[model samples]
Target chain A: MGTQAIRFVGYIFGAALLGLLALPVTSLVGAISVQKFLAGVYHPLFWPAISLSLRTTILSIGFVVLLGTPLAWWMAHQTSRIGRLTTVVVHLPIIMPPAVVGVALLQAFGRKGWFGTLLSAQGLNVSFTVAAVVIAQMTVAAPFYVQASIQAFKKISPDVWVVARSLGASPIEVFLRVGVPMAIPGLISGVLLAWARALGEFGATLVFAGNRVGHTQTLPLAIFYALESDIELALVFSLILVLVGLVVILVISQW
Target chain B: MVDTSLIVQVQVSLGDFMLDVDLSISMKGRLAVIGPNGSGKTTLLKTIVGSVYPDKGHILVGDRVLSDTKLRIEVPVEDRQVGYVPQDYTLFPHMNVINNVAFGLSTGGRRGSRACKKEIALRMLGRFGCQQIAYRPVQQLSGGERQQVALAQALVTEPRLLLLDEPLVALDMTSRRVVRLLLQNYLSQLDIPTVFTTHDVRDVVSLADSVIVLSRGKVVQMGTLEELQKQPCNDFLVEFLGQQ
Candidate 1:
């Protein structure tokens, strides 16, 4: 083919792909009027799903950061076979199908499962509860944060740590003052990515936490339920999620 | 004989390479270690500063024992009171020049408020003619300016021993001459023992009182520059000192 012809064909393909991605969101926004969107916001299902999603996602992100930071730092510094194995293990969740994860979580935490029986003895049941929602979100989102954190920590020069120590800064002092500040930009972007993943979590949560309004029904679950009775409410929830994902992308680009 | 203020006897296995050296140095003058790349010059400095632990042997600076593998006593890096300026002058990129210098005092809880620590850091920068760049980020500094700031940061802690890895290898011709002269004047006035690694012969001629030539992680020769010049021990030394 001629160069000009090839260029024309490339543009056509690019435009088609962009249109395919943008059409769904645009169609959803176009179908709902401002009045319908505002009315959907006041639906009884609206507040419950929004509140549950916000609460569970915030808690899950907190746990992910607290637990992932140290693991990433340790993994960044490790050079052994164990370190390599840990890296593969950390990435497994991201590759595994979400439905499979839900099933595995059930097997581990269900009443008949090993830890489930132990917890049941203590009068605690984790299966299909709000706690199950948080756990499912955490399971799927932790990998993204940990992987990003490892890259951030690894980018730092080893000489900086040695120099800080030589200047009389303790190990903890070095981590807080030097390590955290240097890695802040990467860490922020990582948090945003993990938070977005947790917000949109569907398959795993649906299987593990069941659909119960005002309890385990997050924004995604509410949208799934609303599709049967009211398509307007579902469109509103999707638009909200799309806006949030857009804001995350814009913020990450700043970093 | 001068009193020995620094004693380093170490044997460390670094992957496929092995570093073995034993020496007693007086605090009367500075010592320079010259070697080819991967000759373990930086490794020796790291061992003294307690960054890289020795598999065997002891390191003593003044009256303090920094490490002794036999006795199972290894002082942590922060407690060693050794100042180190690495090859690229790895100043903390997140902080400005003054904050970088003040890190040692502020983090050590050295009997000073934050303002007082900054004042001390500013004074140290002034000594190196770098007060103008105190508030500027370290990323904006020129090569010569970075060397002075690194020196100030290391000195602000008032460490008993100082180690520098490739102090002038990163500078251009003009900045090299300027930084070399500045280092000569400043290092001469300090009383504590200083050990620096270098590739330039001018650094040894102008700054070091004695020299140790290393090859394949072993000290091949140890004496004054003139003595090494009069009797070159190996081809590496002959080529290094430009005696060929």
Candidate 2:
């Protein structure tokens, strides 16, 4: 093909893909009248879902950062086979179907699942609860944070750590003082990505947490419920999620 | 008799290469390690600083046993009191020059307030003619300034031993000569043993009293530069000495 023809074809393909991706968001926003959008905002399920999503996603990301940071640091330093295997295992959630993740969570923490009997014996039931919602979000979102964190930590030259240690800083101190500060920008981006993932988590939460108004129903779950009864409410939820995602992307770009 | 201050006997296997080295240096001695690429020069320095563990070995600096495989005593890197400057200097990019130098004082067992540490760091920088750059961010400094800051950072800790990996390799030719003289002067005043790796013959001639030649992972020769030149070990060494 001629160069001009090839360029024209490339533009067509690129624009087509862009349009396909933009369609759902534009359609959602375009469909909403200000009256309908405000009515959806005032719906009883709206505030509960928003509050639950904010609470659960915040808790989930907090746990992810706390646990995943150290884990990523360890993984980044490993050169052995076990380390590579652990990396693959950590990333499995990102590729695994969210429904499968829900099922796995059920198998691990559901009343009839692996830890169920033991947990129940201690008078603790985790299935279909607000805590379950957080667990589901964490399961689906932890990998994003961990993956980004691994890259962040790995970018640091090994020499920096050695020099820090040689300067009389302990391993923990080196990690906190040198590693964390060096990796802060990458870590912040990771947190934002994980927060966005947790905010938009749906399939796993629906299956694991069981959508219930004011209790386990998060924004995504509420959107699903709203879609069945009122499409306008779903659009409102999606708009809010899109706005949150945009803010995250903006902050990440600043870094 | 010169008092022996540093002793390293270690065996490490890196993939297909094996680094089996045994050496001793006297107090305030400066030893330069020279080798081709992949010859384990940096690895030797790393082993001394407790960054890389040897398969079976012991490292002793002054009276402290930094590592002993048989005795199962391995002093962590922080407690080794060995200052190191890697090839790139690897200054902490997050902090300013004074803070970078003060890091050791604040984090180590030194009992000093933050202000006290900064004062000491600034004093050390002043000694290196870098006091003006104390508040400047590390990333904003030139290559020569980075070297001075790194040196100040390492020296401010009052380490028992110092290891420098290719200290002047990153500098331009003009700055290289300038820093070399600066290094020679400062290193002369230091009472502790100093070990540096360099491919440059000028660095070896000016800074080190003794030289150890490495090939693949083994030491080919260890003696004064004049002694090595009198009887070269391999073609690489012959060519290396020819540069002199």
Candidate 3:
């Protein structure tokens, strides 16, 4: 009964949140107007964010995959208690809200943060630069990659992995040839989700990288920047972001 | 003739149940590990397959020393080539028939690796008379077909040793009889050693060349089917016979 009540409350909260969010969703969708959406696609800011977002998203995904795949595999292969603890730590950022991620990044990478001071001492101007965008994107987005990867590797029966190894595959080959394909569904889901998260990274980028046009203004940050002057333009950017998210989500689901 | 002599010594405890396995099997040999539910038969196999490590002892595959807890010489499973058909026949549900077969081979950056008439998966299927299920999802295959696919999958890798856990236990009697005969015929044609575990007496008498009777985790007896039948060692063997 308690579980049911909790679920009931969850549903109520979800519907209320959806109702509140629906305006932004509709504004985002409506800003398109189909015609403006197409023309908006040709906007200088629009294409730049799209291309930059695409490039950075791809790069971030690549980085996550390179680092995260091995970590996930190691984590999944573990049966010890420490392994379980590590998995919890790895998934912590994924469960955190985007705003918290931004705030955390701000404290850590902002001009006053620890790394910021070190970099400043070294005369490295990383703040409010393109690199800040990548860092902000990575902080908020990398966990999706790790989480997806761990789940993917976990889904593969250890039996298959053992068999693959016994059959003469090196650990690397087993991961590349067998592990990757076997866990493609989870792996791709992780990549697309992480990429999407990175593409639409806002709070972290805004707080850390600032809403500088053509530099760190990814689609989400661009939407916020536009909202200050033109709510319709903000909605237009948001509409495109939602469409891209939907398309990527659809693709990920199919995989 | 390939020398398929096998020897394994292992000791481990899982969830309050202790297991100690010590046995030897020879070329063209069929050893049936007979035991009741939760008697560590699967544990023994998993240890051999390299998924689980024993606390002590060694497994010698031909001249190669596969495991020794003292020296920490534990060979990884990808190098072991011990084909196992787990009880449930956990076939890849997402993959189609041929890809599942190809999973056994090296494809050199290809999607489907075992392309060598990976359809011999088909021949193995044809042996089970399931050639018509070439494209069907394993999830949709009947229990009998699933057993056939599992056997075919285990065979496709051309493993030197085959380990079967309750291969025929899941089948209906009719399917069991057919599958049993097919397996026997196939095994007779090859010299590779095979070990199967089951509580079914029919499984012991029908397929096993020798039997290792395990009760409460220890080997109580080891011999031919007729030998066990002729001299039922104790109440356990007698009761085992009666139940079977």
Q: Identify the leading candidate in terms of lDDT.
A: 2
Error of 2 at A246 (Å): 1.7
Model 1: docking quality category: high
Each model's interface RMSD (Å)?
A: 0.7, 0.7, 3.1
In terms of DockQ, the best-performing candidate is: 2
The DockQ-derived docking category for candidate 3 is: acceptable
Residue B26 displacement in candidate 3 (angstroms): 2.7
Overall local distance difference test of candidate 1? 0.91
Cα lDDT tens digits for candidate 2, A1-255: 999999999999999999999998898788888898788888899899999999999999999999999999999999899999998999999899999999999999999899977998899999899999999999999999999999999999999999999898888888898998899999999999999999999999988989999999999999999899887778888898898898999999998
Candidate 2: which docking quality band?
high
lDDT of 2 by residue, B58-96 (tens): 999977899999999889888899999999988999999
Every model's DockQ: 0.82, 0.87, 0.36
User: Ranking under DockQ, best-scoring first?
Assistant: 2, 1, 3
Best first by TM-score, ranked: 2, 1, 3
lDDT string for model 1 (B1-244, tens) is: 6688899999988899999988777975589998889999999998898878899999999878999999998999999989999989989999999999999997766687888999999999999999999999999999999999999999998999889898998999899999999999999999888999998888999889999988888898999999999998988788878932
Candidate 2 clashes between residue pairs 3 or more apart in a chain or in different chains: none
